[model samples]
Target: MTASSTTTPALAKEVALLAVLATLWGASYTFIRIGVETIPPITFIAARTLIAGGLLVAIIKMRGLSLPKDPAIWKRFFIQACINSVIPFTLIAWAEQTVNAGLATILNSTTPIFAFLLTVLITRHEAVTMRKLLGTIAGVIGISLIIGMEAFQGVGKELVAQLAIVAATISYAAAAIFGRGFKGLDPMMPAAGSMICGAVILIPVSLVVDQPWTIAPSADSLLALLGLSVFSTALAFVIYFRLIHTLGSVSTTSQAYLRVPIGVGIGVIFLGETLASTALTGLVFVVIGVAAMTFPSRKKTVPV
Candidate 1:
């Protein structure tokens, strides 16, 4: 087969996988909102990580893949778990108590912005370019539009919740950079190991703070929790790794751009949520900014 013909089908498949991954992650916000209505944030996150971690373990065993036994590697997994899963999941759940799912997804899409800033400032992995600088400014403006002047007027709990979600996105960015240490390992191992570590950290906190044993969650909440773990966490990770391998990191990360609209659609149809005109406009700018940040730039070739 010609190179063009072969590349076309592969690209199409990757695009399809990207859409599916985006939908799965986008629906996660809606599920978390449903779950947090009855479940405490700590307990909900604990259950999510444990369930998802268990599913990954099963997959690993079924595939006859063995996880690394090095203590240093496990430690890295612990750090990654705290940053990527435990912190972010708990924050998002808490935030959703006051913030709507759609808006939360919009803010969470700022992960790439945080990632870029972290790379340039802390890691020095990439240099700041004009396109990236403009993208970062656009993201800031978009966030301001979404939050609006009204959010600052009252110093309300809602404003704090929104900030917490932003903090979570920053943690996610840090995790992305930190995760590079596991470049040689099987992707499933890091995913499964980190989730397992997250469960360990969260379970005790949930018991102490939430006393989850004392609370009887509703059927809907339980189902939502199940969906969050099985579909969003477990299945999504599988698809994510496949995309990273097949489409490369830049193409895979572009899934963040698709997630906002899918999340907004799910929130509106199922949760009866609505976005303000400004927030909708903000969403557009945020998507464009993130696209600029993550979409790989083409190298200009000078005539030899």
Candidate 2:
């Protein structure tokens, strides 16, 4: 057997894992929607990090590995937690209370676009190309359209929520850029460490402000929280790390736009939600723009 025969099945497996990652993350939008109904955003996200972090820790231990002993590494983990989880996760949970799950999915799915722009401006990590420049313009236009279309409805609080999701998208972009600093470490280290650090940061805030004990979350909310913590956050992180290792960051994150449609479908079917015609149009632009940003160019491009 030649090298081509050996590599094909492995490549196919990575692609399959990417699809699974999209579904898990896509479902998280509905989970947050259901959870934030009764659970406050900070408390909900705190629990999510804590539960998922514990699971990752256990997995590491079972593998006969331990988290880094260096304080510097843990400090970096803390920063990662802020951008990757603590801030963005809380923002998404809070926003989902007002924003529909489907819209949240579309808004948050622009990570690669922002990552690309950041690369162009600050990092200069990736090669600039005509396609990427056009992609950036399309993404900005798509976002503007979504917000502008919503404004006609006089969605005051919803506007703030939408912007919050956008900010979360920015945080995700920075996280991706900073995540490159972890190229030499085991992928699970950042995934697990940042989660644990996020828990440490948020749990105290949840107790003091939300007083989560006083809140009586419903069965659906509890179930959603569990699902979000386990399947979406922990398992999805594991799969994402695996894909990043096997498929490369560009390939792994590129498939994330698939979560947009999956999230919208879950909201429509499970939550009985519907999007306005204008919003649907915006979603189309986002998908197309992200495709332009992330899809492998036929032309030669530099990877940083």
TM-scores of all predicted structures: 0.96, 0.95
RMSD of 2: 2.6
* Candidate maximizing lDDT: 1
The candidate that achieves the highest TM-score relative to the unseen native structure = 1
TM-score of 2: 0.95
Clashing pairs in 2: none
TM-score for candidate 1, please give it.
0.96
lDDT of 1 by residue, 1-304 (tens): 7778999988898899899999999999999999999999999999999999999999999999987899999999999999999999999999999899999999999899999999988999788999989899889888989887558597778889988999999999999999998899999999999999999999999999999989989999999999999999999999999888998888789988889899999999999999999999999899989988888988897865
Evaluate model 1: give its lDDT: 0.93
Find the 10 residues in a row with the least total lDDT in model 1: 147-156
Local lDDT at 113 for model 1: 94
Clashes of each: 0, 0
